[model samples]
Target: MKNIFSPIEQIDNLDAKVIAGIERLATLFKSSLQDTAKRYKLTPLQAQLLIFIAEHSTKLCSVTMLAKEFSVTKATASDSLKTLVNKSYIEKVYNPDDARAFSFVIVDIAKPMVNELTHFGLLMSSSLSSLNENELIQLCHLNLKMLNIFSQSGLITCRMCYSCQYYQQKNGGFYCHLMKKELPAKALRLDCPEHLKSS
Candidate 1:
């Protein structure tokens, strides 16, 4: 009997190779990130958050929201947030909408640190010069698709790049308008870690 709803073979041998290559890419990036982060005294998670905040400086972000987005416990997020706050990397903001809530804005002084991470993308692109544009495009498409699949499957919850937010480009990249005054990149989070979501 013919199977009416059999699954199709989407990933073939070549696809497997591509997947392997993607895994290699991730490993290499992670390794490099760890080394770079160690030199700068930051963890991979911190680097990710720093980049996010630097790129989205204009927007407001909360530790609770960050915890949920990163699939981390609120306590973990708060702990990490506290470290950043103490280090003068991220500042906290109070919410006018709800005094009980707070938001985090990145400091411009940390731009140099953020730029270090950006350099990785440049390095990778230059190293993979042999790969044609179309191939690179295909790889990006597939990788994004795979990420979506994982996120949808509950492997991850969020996949947003803070830099891609709307507010970052505004306010000269510091203290999103939500804050009463222009706070430094590492102003101070309110007692609470809840506030409005920013771009």
Candidate 2:
């Protein structure tokens, strides 16, 4: 029952439904992640920052680095880190190479919270643990193709519209660099199905 359609034709036929489903799935993921983050008393950005920091456990991070990574102003990054520090979740250490910059460290008091985040991620991973080797590999490949198409579509979201730090500093508040309009201070999202993270 093999059809004589060209590769691109086959792709075009599958593209619309698959892309729409993937985008919807991403929306679901965001909602679920938001719920999980709330359980830990973390804002979406805070949770994302924590995850990024934990992933780069081998390297010391800086406010400037985070600002660049998240497409936020250095002042915004400093304030977010300050909030975490005040909560005793993270600590700032003086950098030997640069006196003006400080390195980040996870405070011992936050291990439980951090560990819970890990546990939640693992729980989600385990939801797919039933898939055997081939299925998992195939799924990975499918996701890669989906992401490739999504990236090529040129509809990804901008960070300026997504970070809380960006909005607080602007006079109008909640500025969307892409839209040039005032956005909801809390959401900080592009209201799009497909968005990109600078990091």
Local accuracy of candidate 1 as per-residue lDDT tens digits, 1-199: 2232222332344555655666678898888777777777888878777776666433336886677666788898888888888899888888788888888888778788778866777887798899887777666555555664665566765432222122233366434344434534333232222343233
Backbone clashes in model 1, listed as residue pairs: 91-187, 92-188, 92-189, 102-194, 106-185, 107-185
What would the per-residue lDDT of candidate 2 be over residues 118-144, giving only the tens digit for each residue? 665666688898998778766764554
lDDT of each: 0.63, 0.61
Instruction: List TM-scores for all candidates, in order.
Output: 0.65, 0.57
Could you say which candidate leads in lDDT? Answer: 1
Misplaced by over 4 Å in model 1 are 1-21, 57-60, 158-199
RMSD of candidate 2 to true structure, Å: 16.1
lDDT of 1: 0.63
For candidate 2, what is the TM-score? 0.57
Name the 10 consecutive residues with the lowest summed lDDT in model 1: 160-169
